[model samples]
Target: MTTTPARRRALVVRGGWDGHKPVEATDMFVPFLEDSGFDVRIEDSNAVYADREEMDRTDLIVQCVTMSEISPEALAGLIGAVERGTGLAGWHGGIADSYRNSSDYLQLIGGQFVTHPARHPDQREGGEADNFLCYTVDVTDLGRTHEIMSGVEDFTLRTEQYWVLTDDLNDVLATTTHPVQPYHPWHRPVTTPAVWTRAWGKGRVFVATPGHSLPVLRDTSVRTIIERGMLWASRTASE
Candidate 1:
C-alpha cells in the first residue's frame, strides 16, 4: 500500500503590541508555509506556550510578539520545546524584543533588541528614537553558502535598523552598518547583524531584523531571505 508523507507542522504565535503589525506580518507568511506543505496553526495568545504537548509535536514556532510578558509556565514550555529540538524563528522586536524580562528567552534567541537610533532634535544622552533610515544589508561570505541566503544578495532598505545586544554564538548571515549622525553619539559606523542563526539544542533558530513593516517584509530580497530562513529553521528537506 502507498502512504503519504506526513506534513511538517508550524505554529505561529502572534500578538503583543499592534505596532509591529503582528497580524499582518504573520499573515504574509501563513500561506507560504501552507503552500510549502506545513500544517500551520495560528494563535494570538502566548498561552499556547503552556501546552507542552502541542509544542513537542510542532516542527517550528514563528513568533511575532513584541514587548509582551510571558507567564513563567508558558515561558518554560517555550524554552523547553526549543531546547528539545523544535525550531524557533522570528523577525524584529517580535522575537528579539519580546519578553524583555526573560533572561532565559534572551539566551535562547542569542540576541536582544536594545534600540533603533534615529535622528531627532532633542535626543538625550541615552534616549530611544523611532526614526527610519536607509541602509544596505550585505550578505556575508558565510551567508552566501547558507541555505537561508542562497539567492539573496546585498541590498539597501529604508527602515528602522535595529541595534541589538547579541551573543557570540550566532552564525551571522547578513549585516548592516549604522552610520554616525549628528543626533547619534557614536562617531563611527556601527555594524550589526541583519540576519543570523543559532542553535538551541537540536533545534535551529533564525532571525531577520529588517521586517519592521509589511512593505519592508515584502521587499524582494527580504521576503526571499525570510522564506528561506523559515524553511531552514524548520530543517525542511527541500531547504
Candidate 2:
C-alpha cells in the first residue's frame, strides 16, 4: 500500500515593533508555506518558543519580531530547538534586530543591525522615506552559483540601506555598500552583508537585510530570494 508523507511544520513567531509590519509581512508567506506542504502555525509571542513539545517537532521557523525582549527561558528554548536542527529564516530587523539584549540569540543568527544611516538631517525627521536611497545589491562570486541566488543578477533598490554588524562565519551571498556622505560620520564607504546563511548544528539559518517594508519585500527579486531562502533554510532541505 502507498502512504503519504507527513507534512512539515512551520511556526511563524511575529510581533514586536509594528513598524516592521510583522503580522503583515509574515502573512504574505503563510499561504506559500501551506502550499509547499507545511502545517503552518502562527503565534504572536515568544512564549511559543519555550514549548519544547511543539518546538521539537517544528521543521521550520519564520520569525519577524523586531527589537523586542525575549525571556531567558524562551531564548534558551529557541537556541535548543535550532541546535537540534529546526530551521530558522527571516529578513531585515525582524531577525537581525530582534533582541538587542540577547547575545546568545545574536550568536545563533551570526549578525545584527547596527543602523540604517540617514542621508540628511531633514530625511531623519521624515521617517523611513528619509533613509531611502538608490543602491546596488552585488551578488558575490559564490552567490552567483548558490541555489538561493541562482538566476538573480546584481540589482539596485531604492530603500533604507542597512549597516549591519556581521562576522566571518556566515556564507554571504550578497552585499551592499553604504557610501560616505558629507552628513554622515563615517570616513570611508562601508559594505555590509545583505543576504547570508549559517549552518548551526543540524539547523540552517537564512537572513536577508533588504526587507524593510512591504514594497521592498515585494520587489520581484527580493521576494524570490526570500522564498528560496525559506526553503533552503528548512529542515528537509538538502545539505
Clashing pairs in 2: none
> What does each candidate score in C-alpha RMSD?
3.0, 1.5
Backbone collision count in every prediction?
0, 0
lDDT of 2 by residue, 162-208 (tens): 88898998999999998888988889999999999999888999999
Model 2 bad stretches (over 4 Å): 122-125, 237-239
- Among residues 3 or more apart in sequence or in different chains, the pairs in candidate 1 whose N, CA or C atoms overlap within 3 Å are none
Q: How close is candidate 2 to the true structure, as a TM-score?
A: 0.96
Q: What lDDT does each candidate get?
A: 0.89, 0.92
Name model 1 segments beyond 4 Å from true: 120-130, 235-239
Measured by lDDT, the strongest candidate is 2
lDDT string for model 1 (1-239, tens) is 99887899999999998989999999999999999989999999989999989998898899999999999999999988888888899999899899999999999988899888775666434522346777899999999999899878899987888898897999999998888887778989989898999988878999999888899999999899989888888845443
